[model samples]
Target: MAFEELGRFGVWRPFGGFGSEDARELEALGYGTLWLGSSPPGDLVAAEELLAATETITVASSIVNIWSEPAAKVAESFHRIEARFPGRFLLGIGAGHPEIAAAYKKPYDALVEYLDALDEAGVPAEARALAALGPRVLKLAERRSAGALPYLVPAAHTASAREILGDKALLATEHKVVLDADPARARATARPRVDFYLGLQNYTANLRKFGFTDEDLTKPGSDHFYDELVAHGDATAVVDHLAGHLRAGADHVALQVLDDDGQATLRALAPLLREVA
Candidate 1:
């Protein structure tokens, strides 16, 4: 139940985005974990490569879409990585969007079944996390897995999620960052990614729960919405905003730099965040 390995903040990147050098640099910068986003394959080779590259710092999947991956196979990968790297990797799984997934149905039930499979395969709950957004799945994460790792969420959602998961479960929320000082430029940078998530029902539903209306979730999204979800501005401002999640009750915040390759943003924020961490 101890998530000290995850530390105070982690880097969130797309699959195949980081090389061995990037992994080492992030470890050197004092980031506690590196999370691979965009539903990596069940083999988890990317995770293995990163873990192999770095001496410490946990590497995790932001999520592996359960709709596209078989639970048993993913569990096998978990055991493999755990055997080699031990506590250095965490498995994060989700049901994904129904619009894109043809087989998506009864997601909550499917997740229950999937966890059952992992359990049968001997993958311990504490070693895995769920890509949970709403009350139901968040509760399930609290009961069945290590905790919830919700993406594209604001600190308000983190606070609510903390209420649901209580104090013990790992609450690692992924918030995007655009390190531009100009509000206009920052919002522009965040729009495409925010718009992409808006098209998905799950994200919209979760946003609505946090008081984002149709206008706020509309194309281009509102400035307030952008500010809430994507931390922008100078490194100090960005670090302060990310710290909001910790204050709101998250154990860790996963930083997904929107425009940069993640290196510059991480390097810039590392010093300021070290004290916070």
Candidate 2:
């Protein structure tokens, strides 16, 4: 249940052939956790595989959707993983977006109800986190789970989230990174990955709160927006940018690289990550 168990830095990637394999390597590089993002299995199948891969690093789901995954089933899956891995699994759950929700009513109410179900199903509050962005949800995260996992947000949002969460709960933010020397190509790599997110109200509204203009949020996202959110350039520059999130408020920054070969990308940054550690 302790946040430190999750580590100070981690890698957040979609399920891939090298997921567990790369997880072992990241562990050696001094990373504390490996997060499987972009909605994972309702059974938490990946969590078991991840924990089995490394001896110490915590394995977390960036989110399991509340609208789709039943709390009882999810809790059961958590127990299954924890039984084998013990304290190495973190269950991050979210209400998801309106577009994906079958019946998106009061999302806050749904999230609360979901948490209540987890509480009844024997899921410990310290083992889970809410993918919250707004104030209401941030407050809910403070009370219900370990802390908040805000994705596609700037350092300002992390500062605000930390203020709302206070000092006790964990504040793990996802920082998208592109380690490329070429500005055009680096931004090109990041834009496509986040374009769909801009369409999602939760992400866009959060961006607006940080003072992003309407123009900055358009189709491909403006240069200013890219520079504001993504950590690009060489390995040192990217590491420095990621450090800014920690300086702002993040307890941990889950690095999400915008590259086809995630394993290779991380390999290149091993030295930089070591310096951070």
- TM-score, each model? 0.98, 0.96
Indicate the residue-level lDDT of 97 in model 1: 92
Q: Whole-model lDDT, candidate 1?
A: 0.91
lDDT by residue for model 1 (73-171), tens = 999999999999988998999999998999989999999999999999999999999999999999999999999999989888999999999989999
* Model 2 residue 267 distance off true place after TM-score fit, in angstroms: 1.6
lDDT of 2 by residue, 125-214 (tens): 999999989999999999999999999998998899999999898999999889898988989999988788878888888899899999
Superposition error at 61 for model 2 (Å):
0.8
Model 1, runs deviating above 4 Å:
none
Q: What is the lDDT of residue 129 in candidate 1?
A: 95
Best by lDDT: 1
Record all residue pairs in model 2 with backbone atoms less than 3 Å apart, i.e. clashing.
Answer: none
After the best TM-score superposition of candidate 1, give how far the Cα of residue 186 lies from its true spot, in angstroms: 1.0
Reference-based TM-score, model 1: 0.98
**For model 2, how many clashes?**
0
